[model samples]
Target: MGFTDDGDIAAYRRRRSVEFKHGRIAMLATMGFMTPEIIGHWPGYLSPSMGLKFADVPNGLAALNVVPSLGWTQIVIYFGLIEYSGGFEDYRSGTPGDYAWKALTSDDPEDKRRRLNVDLANGRLAMVAIMAILFQNGVAGTTGPEMWIPAL
Candidate 1:
């Protein structure tokens, strides 16, 4: 359901490539993900398709509470790693190339489809992390102290 225009396709290709690369990084980070706090809330900002969702952390936390400690830190680390790894240009540039030649001509439609799938999947995971934080903080407007925060 993405734009088929030349410019749109170009953007999609570039974004897809970056996301494919980022997903690898995320997988590595999550390999030993013990707590929701460590992963940080993503809300799938990088992905184009999926919208945001809550995290799966047992003790729910919210945006305001987690943004400073967990969310911002995770964003910094993710971007930092991406930069150190020399994926900054690919991450920043959002353009597609001869996608047909790359996806269909060389690989099959299924192979090309997996690239988009990764984006969607990564987005979902990020949303879940965000939701976990929001839930812990009672972001739905209920009153509660964040478990990770020192209770007064």
Candidate 2:
């Protein structure tokens, strides 16, 4: 059966709810604590305070490791690419919680797809930059993506 107007509305609502849930999950993940098991560890009133102590681990430790290995020229290029990719990842992941802050943030499915495409492109570029820098600095050999897959 074809979807009626009500069905479409319901689907839209469901999709929006999923997106908001993802946003919340991202926030919680970034917070470092509040995993289901840990939620009960803190007292009800002091949960926020307790969570703050356990949570708050910084993201992008891999990116941080890339820094010391890059040489002078590679450092500049790698860092620039990393920064760009990081921004793209944040956009695609929607973990920064800035969706409403942007003027043209769209809930359209097509727009979301476009954002994902950008995210993928940026991610690939970032990886390439990292590998090139690493290869130049003798951190990685010339085995290409295959070399990293096994390690992952």
Candidate 3:
């Protein structure tokens, strides 16, 4: 039996497409808010013992410093992977989730399973790396509860 024969490929694609679009929108919105959020707190209010101070660095350098120090590079890397993995093409074609869904529903079940496994593994790795950075910066500790409370 073929892979497409096991299920409705079109329906699966449509459902996956909607999910992908929603996830992309949510991710982009979060990143938009998180960049400034981190910039406001990092190195200024939440600098670790040896962390660079925003005030000590020039404006240009400080802006550059936040990119790597605040885990923004991970966001960059995620988007980069999306683009490289054909997600960008799917988006450009107005089918936001086709790339991944196609891979998951491809004719070769073994290949599909392998791709999904790798994607899952990579996602976990990224999460671990981000958590490690947060811990390294002391953001994971209970010492700064007040710093996390958003001001209205």
Instruction: Report the number of the highest-lDDT candidate.
Output: 3
lDDT of 1 at 135: 57
Off by over 4 Å in 3: 1-7, 40-152
Which ten-residue region of model 1 has the weakest summed lDDT? 90-99
lDDT (C-alpha, whole model) for all candidates:
0.49, 0.43, 0.50
Off by over 4 Å in 1: 1-7, 18-81, 88-119, 128-132, 135-152
lDDT digits (tens) for residues 1-152 of candidate 1: 54545566556666666565555555544432334445554454432333324452233333444333555678889988867985444433532222244532235556655655655577558656544544544655422334346767
- Tell me the deviation in Å of residue 112 in model 2: 1.2
Instruction: RMSD for all candidates, in order, please.
Output: 12.7, 18.2, 12.6
Candidate 1 has an lDDT of 0.49
lDDT of each residue in 22-132, candidate 2, tens digit only: 544444343332232234233333225334321232122322433233233675898679656744333344432234423334477577656644544444455455445
Give the alpha carbon lDDT tens digit for every residue of 20-123 in model 3: 54554544444443454446434473345656565443322234555445456676888778667843444345433436467444557677656655554544
In terms of lDDT, the poorest run of 10 residues in model 3 is 137-146
